[model samples]
Target chain A: MVNHSKKSINQYAGYIYLLPGLAWIFFVFAIPIIQLIGMSIRQGPVGQEILGFDNFIFTFRDPLFIKAITNNIKLLVIVPILIILSLIFSTFLYERIKGWQIYQTIIFIPVILAVAAMGIVFSQILQLKGLLNETLRVLRLNFLIQDWLGNQGLALGSVVGVIVWKELGFGTILFLARLMSVDKELYEAARIDGASGFQLMIHITIPQLIHIIEFYAVLLIVTAFSFVFDYILILTNGGPNNQTIVGEFFVYKYGFIYNRFNIASSVAIVYLLVGIVLMILRYQIVKRIDS
Target chain B: MKKIALSRIMKQIIMITMVVIALVPIYYVFVTMFKSPDEYLFNKWGLPLELSLENFKRLMEGETIFRWLINSLIISGFSVLISILVASMMGFAIARFDFPGKSALFVAVTSLLVLSPAVLVIPLFKSMVKLGLINTYYSAIIIYTGIMLPISTYLLTNFFKSIHNDIIDAALIDGCSLFQIYYRIMIPLSMPAIVTAALTNWLYVWNEILIGLIFLQSDKMRTLMPGLSLFKGKYTTNIPLTMAGVAVAIIPTFVIYLMGQRYFVKGLTEGAVK
Candidate 1:
């Protein structure tokens, strides 16, 4: 009984200690989400009188909204493909192979550089007069040279490729770390049992990586949604006629550029909901797999 | 013996090809930084036949790149320092003390890990405006602190939990105050994790552009990312000079990462594992 009382007292004190962090979150995160939802429901210009649901309706009806949603869906599709590629690369590198560290370091260098720097470098590299086209010309494949970033269809793909190159190393490193942690005995046992390398990987290594995979999947989803700033903004600015505008860029444009706070808030709220759902789905998947 | 040697050579060739593909762009940027505009346009990938410091000199002397660099340093430095201090204190408190609602607080803090800055930019802008902090260094610093605190605290909390309670108890028995124990013992014990967190946070703050772009409007306050955009207008087609700017921006972080590779790798892998 005395121990229980002490535990209760400690629990109370824990709440008190937690007050600052909790309050900050409530103010910064919870309250902003609430305000976003509120703003979404109300229609007005910046600092104007609230008109119910008008801004949301405007946002929903806007052609750019659909474009943004479709672009985001495309990104969602593309990101997982890169993640799979990273997994394969990571597994290959994790074999304690010669020069593994050098490869790892080289691959990860792009990630260490700022995305803004990446955008500048890639833009120059892919420009019409840039190295890529110049290389084609030098090879006497002049007919093959084209304006890579200028083409509407090609521009989005180019940006996505940059995103993959920028992100893959980090993902590979993450998976490699997890792979290293898996007990070598499992691999050795499988090998002793006459399991092939592929079979061992499928049955043992992949299964062991389920948790880390889910964690990274959630992270990738969040990053895909929020972190395409330099590529999209710099490469295309959601253009070749708004063909590459993701939701976050849309929100930024609406809020800051168009000064449509209501619409921006609505988009933000929708993004928040989508993010929460994705996270919850990931959690459920992980839980089910763990169980 | 010939067959085995041939296979080894083939593997080396493949590895070299992969390394070349990865390093080409990095090399391209670095080489271009030292080349004249004519050399850059004519031989985009070649080693500079006549190396020049003119691009670097021009960037430093003409453009506001230096100012932007200083601004980035100040904002990222202060923000990282404040984050470490606040996060360590909170992490130590949670790890050592048996307190109320601890689990709930932990959950709340960790949940912020899922919340991205893109979602918070507008609302944060509003808050900053209301607080009269727009276009101020304080706005950038506070936002960085607020957003970063949760993750840093989570990392440090995990680190603190790994430490044995016996040492802390002994310190308490010796009549050491909580702050002293934290400063003298916990901090030293968790130095690796602390350093890792600091370095990670520093890289993040240094690289972050979206928030910096929105919160800071003044030419003087603009960071490397936004400030570099100005060069695009002036140079218009000068890829080499722009590449120079990129090289300059990346070198500091690269050096820092190289210096702290062990802590960085350990911290990243260990934090994720936990």
Candidate 2:
């Protein structure tokens, strides 16, 4: 009887421990999300009439929204590119290339940097008279030089280039970390069987690192969708006729820039659903990886 | 043997080219910050003929830069501290205790780990305004702590669970309370993971621009990244001066990251990769 009461007391103590964290989460996350839902169904930023689905309809019909979603999808191209580059670079490091340690350390410098600051740096470099153009001109490759961030046709592509440069470090390190853990015996066995480097990579390395690849790929996709705002805001400010506008930037524009809270919340609800789905996919993949 | 040597050299070349690409802009930022406007215009691609502190001097002459740095330190330091305290306690409970809704709470945290705060910014902003927290340090600190808590708890809980249950069980037999077991056994044992979580949160809170941009819009209240980003816009014509601001903004985080990179990488890849 004493033990039973003690068990209850411990259970209550567990609640006591969780109370502060849970309270903060409830107030900060849960309440705002609930309020987000309520605002999405209303009319204006401060409008009050129950106009169910209207804000969502307006958001869907907006051309800028269509452009933003299209740009986000276009940026999805970066995922496969990132995976490929990261795989190749990490494989080089995994093979212990000359100066691999130096390369690894320098490669990750961009990943640790503030994207906003890097965007400022890139803004200077990609300017028409900037270092990139200067170098191209000196190389007698002036044909390759264009107004990288100023031109509508090339702005999104330029943004993608910058994103790849900054984000590649992270993917390389992630893949390298996983590669470092693979069973060496598997590779030794493959080598004794006369498997060439390329063949071993295709057969052994790819299969061994598939789970990390999936984890990293899904993460890159999520990044492409929601994490491009800083790049947009800092690099182009969604300019060149809004060519570089993305989903998160779209939401930012409506909510903060235009004071269209209702519409922004509606778009956010869409993104929230998408984010939840991606989170579920990620969780399942993580579970599979663990098991 | 000749073919293998060729391929090896080719790999070195490829890697070297990528390294240059990765580093040139960072090199540019540091180099340009020391150049005068005329020198910047003339020598866009080389070291300054002479080291000049004029740009930095001009930047420091304004008090806003110092204010922004202090604000960043306060918000990031405070949020990471609160997040560690609250998250460690919650992780202790979830990892070490038998309780109702435990699985539910765990699931909620893991799920929210992937939920970007960008999606909820509008309503969060409104709520912050309602709480009279707009333009105050608390606005960003509270939200940053909230956003970081789930991941922090997730990391700490996993770390705490990996601690042998035998230790806690033995402590319980010795009549140590759960709180006692937590501090005496968990915190000290989980130092690496806690530092990893703390560094991760610090990096996130420090580099985060969107939350700070909206929540702490007042000039005196702005943090480093957002302040520099705004500074970039106003001084776009003054490249050297702007680069100086960028330098100031990125250097602190860069130094910290270099010092604590092990924790940073571990924190980043902990749950995801492992």
Top candidate (lDDT):
2
In model 1, what is the error at residue B16, expressed in angstroms? 3.3
**What DockQ number belongs to candidate 1?**
0.45
lDDT of 1 by residue, A227-278 (tens): 7766787777788788889888887888888877667777787778777876
**Candidate 2 residue-wise lDDT, B162-246, digit = tens:** 9997777688889997789888999999999999999988988888899988898889999999998898879978999998888
Model 2: iRMSD? 2.2
Q: Calculate DockQ per candidate and list them.
A: 0.45, 0.67
Tens digit per residue, CA lDDT, model 2, A10-74: 88888888999999898778887888777777665357685678777777888888898899889
In candidate 2 the C-alpha lDDT for residue B122 amounts to: 86
Q: All candidates' lDDT scores?
A: 0.77, 0.87
* C-alpha lDDT (0 to 100) for residue B186 of candidate 1: 90
| Number of backbone collisions per candidate | 7, 0
